[model samples]
Target: MSRRDSLPPLNPTRAFEATGRLLSVSKAADELCVTPAAVSRQVRALETFLGVSLFERIRGGLELTPAGARYLSDLMPLFSALRESTEGVMAGAPGRSNVLRIRSPATFAVRWLIPRLASFHRLHQDIDVQLTTGSAPLDFRREDIDAGIQLGDGDWPETHSQRLIPNELIPVAAPSRARRKGWKLERETLLHSLARPEDWTLWLKFAGFSTANTNRGMRYETSLLAYQAAVEGHGVAIAQKALVLKELEEGSLVAPFDMTLDRGGHTYYFAWPSHRPESKSLKAFRQWLAKVVR
Candidate 1:
C-alpha cells in the first residue's frame, strides 16, 4: 500500500480529536452534534487504524492512554492550523467580510444585548451581526455561529468565555402594585421562572429569609415572561439585575429590597470556541460588549 493509503479516514481523525480533547465521548458527541454511539464507533475505527488503544476506562470514565495522549498532542497544532487557514480563506471571500453569526439566550438578548446593539452598530458600521437566540451549547464544527453570549462561570469545555455582566439577583414588582400592597415578601405572591427555579430560593437565602414559600407562586416558562408578569403587576419576580436595568430605570419595575444576591461565578459571558481564530467581527463585538457592560 502507498504511504497515503495508511492514513486514517478524515471522519475518524476528527472524532478522535474531539473525543481525545474533551476526554468524554458524551461531551465530544454534544460538541460534534452527533450521537454517543456514533462517536464511539468512529473512535473505535480510529483505534483500529492506529493499532493502539487510544483510551482506557477508569472508574467508569474515560482516560487517555500514553499513546493516545501523544497522538493527540501531535494532532492539536495541525487541527489549529487547519482551522486558521480555513478561516482566512473564508474571511477574504466576497460578501462574507466582517459578517458575524452569533447566538444568545432569548431573555438576555431581548432584555440586555438587543437594547444595547444599536450603539454597537453606530460605532462599527462595517461589521454585520446576525444574532440568534438560544441557550444551547456552542458547536463551532457543527454550526455556523461565530460566538455566543452565554451564562456561566467561563468553565465551558473547549470554549473561551469572556465575562460580560455579573449576575446579581433582586426582586422586582410594578410600582403601582408595590405601592398598593406594600410589597411584603410574606404577603405577596412570588413569581417564578420555570427556567430558573432557584433564583428566588437563592435570593431568599442571601437575604436571611426562609425559602419555605418560594415554591408557592405563579410559574412562567421563561425569565422574560416572568419579568413581563412583574411589569403587569401580577406578582413580584426575581430578576437578574442586568436584565432589569432598563425597566428599573424607566420605572416599569421597582426593587423594594435593599439586598442583592450576587450569584457567585455564574455570569453573562461572550464565548467562542477556544480553538478557532477570532474574527474581526468577533473582536469588534467583544470590545463593544466590554465597553457597554462597564
Candidate 2:
C-alpha cells in the first residue's frame, strides 16, 4: 500500500487544514480553544506524516506553500459540506431545539427589540433568541438566521415580510433641552437621524411651518444615537414614534409639538426566507410579536 493509504485518520488533516486556512497556529488554536503550542505540534505532526513543508515563514505571518494551497483548496469543500450536513441534521431534528438567530439593524435591535425581549422570553420559554446587529442585509442561506427585522418598504424580493409597525416620524427633544431653551419650538436646534433625511422637512410641512431649515444640523446614523444626542441637550431629533415611545413616556424625551408625518415608505418589517417556513418556536415568537406590537 502507498504511504498516503497508510496515513492516520482525518483529525490531523483537519487540524492542518484549519491552521493553513487561518495562516496562524494561534488563530487556529483560538478557534479550537487550545494552546498555540498544541496547534503547532499538530501541524508539525501532519507535516512529518505527509513528508512536505506546508508553510513558509514571512515577516509577520505565515504564508502557504504551493502544496499547502492545493491541499487547502481540496479540503475546503469537504469541510463546508460536512458543516452543512451537520447543521442540516441539527436543524431538522425535533428534540434538540437550538437558538433562533435573528439579524437586525443595530439601532432597532437596541432601542426596540432588546427592551421587549423579556416579554418574548416570558411567552415562549423554550425558544432562545440570538440577536446579531448589523447594517447589512442577511442572506438566509449564507447565514444561519431564522428571522430578521428590517426597515424598508414591504417589498423584499424572494422573502416573506410582514409589516410590524406603521411609519410615523415626529420631532422630539430632551426634556432638559426643552426646559433650558424654553418652549420655543421655532428656535430649537435640530438633530437629524440619517435614516430619514427628509423627515424634518416632512414634519415641518405637516406642522404648517414650511419656512424652517430642515437640511442644516448635526446628523446621526441611527435613532439610538439621535436619542442620546438629544438627551445630552445637543439638539432636537426627528424620531420614529415606535422607537421613542418608551423614552417619551419616561420623560427622557419630549415631543413639544403635536405635528407628525405619515411617510409611505420605511416601516418596520419581520422577514424570513419565503421558501423556508417558520419552525414551531419561530412561529410562536412571531405570533407573540404580532400580539405585542398590535
Candidate 3:
C-alpha cells in the first residue's frame, strides 16, 4: 500500500473537471455521454472523497469555488500529458490508430473539403480522416492534431503553410433569384456573415459602393451559412467564388454578376507544424491536397 494508491476514480475526476470547466452539469454530461444527474452525482462523489467543496451552486449556474478553480488549473495539464503519453504508447501498438486529426474551419470543411474527402479515402484506404472545425487559435503542441486548413495570408508562425485556393468575393444567389432580380446588385436584399464583416464591405468597395452607406440584411455565423441562404433564395450573398465553384457549376446556385473582389490577403492554406515528425500518410494527403488545389 502507498499514498499514491488512494486516488479517486478517473470518471468522477473527469466529471468534476468538465463540470467545473464548463460551469454546467448538463454540458459536462453531454460531453461525457452521461446524464446531468449522473454528472452531479459524480461531482458530489469527488467532493466527498476529497472533503472539499469544488463548486457553488448559483441561481442559474454553477461557479467554481476558489479552491476548485485552482484545482482545475492544476489538473488540466496533468490530464493532457496523460493523454499524450497514452496516445504515444497506443501509436506503437499494432492496429491501434490510422487516424489523421485535421483541424479546419466550418465554412471550408462543409463547402469545399468534405466533398473531396472521398477521393482521399479512395487513395488511402488505411488512413481514417477525422475533421474537427473551429476558428479558435490552434496550438499544435497542446492539441492532438495532424494538420489544418486555414483561410488567410499564408503566414503562420512556426508552421509550414502553402496557399491552396485563391480567394475572390463575388455576389451570388439561386439561379431563379438571380434571373428575377437581374442587374440590381444594390437593390437586392444582402446576406452577410457575422464572422467576416469585412467580406461584404470589401466587395461593396470593389463594386464602387460607399461601404459607409451600405444596406443591412440578415446575418449568419459563417460564409457557408450565408452562401446557403443565397442558394435557398433568401438573398444575395457575397461569397468566395472558389469555394462555391461546385455549386455554380452544379446549377444549385448562380452568380448574379461577373464582378469579383480578389484581395491578396484572403486565401486558403494547407498547414502543419514545422516541427511535427512527418508520416507517410500525412505526406500523401498533403500531396493529394496540392494536386486538388492545382
Candidate 4:
C-alpha cells in the first residue's frame, strides 16, 4: 500500500488538529458540532496511529505533550493558509449568494436581533441572516461570516465599522422579585453578568451610594442568564437598558432607579471586511439598521 493510503482518514486528522489548536476536546466538539466523546475518541485514534501521546491530563484539563506542542507549531501556519485559500475560493464562486452570516454576542442575538428579525425579513426578503453567537472577536477575512455586530471600543483596525447604538446601563429586576422581597434598589442582592463585573459598582456610584459590598452578587456570563435569574426573582442585575427595553415595556422587569450610566467606554458596532463585495442586500440591511437606531 502507498504511504497516503496507509494514513488515517482526513476527519480524524481534522479532529486532532482542532483539539490540538483549542487544547480542549469539549471546545473542539463545540466548534465541530460533534460530541466530546467523539472528539476524544478521534484524538485517541490519531495518537494510536501516530504512536505518540498528544495530550496529558493536568488539573482536570488537557495539556499538549511536547510532541503535540511541536506538531501544533508546525500545523498552525498551514491551517491559516488553508483558511485563507478557502475564503478566496468561496468569495470568487459564482451563483452562491443566498446566505449572510453574522456574528454577535449571545445575549444581543437573543434579545435584540431575534425580536426585530421579522422586520428585517419583511423589508429584505431576499437575504437570509444566519447568526453565530459568541463573545470572541471574529476574523472577517478568515471566517465565512459576512458581517458582525461587535461590542467593544470602536477600534477595529481593518474593517468597515459603523456604530450601531450607544447604550446606557441600569439596575433592573423582575417586578415579582421587587414585590416579594420588598426590595428597594438600595437593599437588593446584586446579580452580576460576568461580562461587566464593575457594572453594579459604577451604577451605585452614579446613584450616590458608596457601600463597600456593591460588587457582591451572583455572577453570570451572559445577559440572557442574568435576565433569567432576575426574572426568577434571584437578584437585581445591571443590564443595557436598550436590550431590556421590550421586557421593561411589558412589565416583566422594572428599573428601580432612574439613573443611567454612560457606557461610552464601549458600544455596539456593525463591521464587515473592507475587501468583500458589498451586495445590494447587505446595503439594504445596513440602511435599515441605521434607521432603526436613529
Best by TM-score: 3
Arrange candidates by TM-score, highest first: which order? 3, 4, 1, 2
- TM-score of every model? 0.68, 0.68, 0.72, 0.69
lDDT of 4 by residue, 192-215 (tens): 878767777887888888764775
Model 4 earns a TM-score of 0.69
Q: Which lDDT tens digits does candidate 3 get at residues 206-264?
A: 87877444447888999989999999999888888888998999998898677888877
Better of 1 and 3 by lDDT: 1
As for lDDT, the candidate ahead, 1 or 4, is: 1
Off by over 4 Å in 4: 1-97, 179-182
Please give the range of 10 consecutive residues that has the lowest summed lDDT in model 1. 1-10
Measured over all alpha carbons after superposition, the RMSD of each candidate to the real structure, in angstroms, is: 7.2, 8.0, 5.8, 6.4
Stretches of model 2 off by over 4 angstroms after superposition? 1-96, 180-183
lDDT-sorted candidate list, best first: 1, 3, 4, 2
Cand. 3 Cα-lDDT: 0.80
- The global Cα lDDT (0 to 1) of model 1 is 0.83
Q: Give the best candidate by lDDT.
A: 1
Q: Write the per-residue lDDT of candidate 1 for residues 1-294, one digit (tens) a residue.
A: 854355444388888888887788898777677778888999999899889999997897898899998998778767756655665686678765456788988898898888889999899876778899876777554445778988777888888888888899999999998888455788888999887888998898889887458878899988999999999999999999988988999999999999999987898888888877776778888888888878
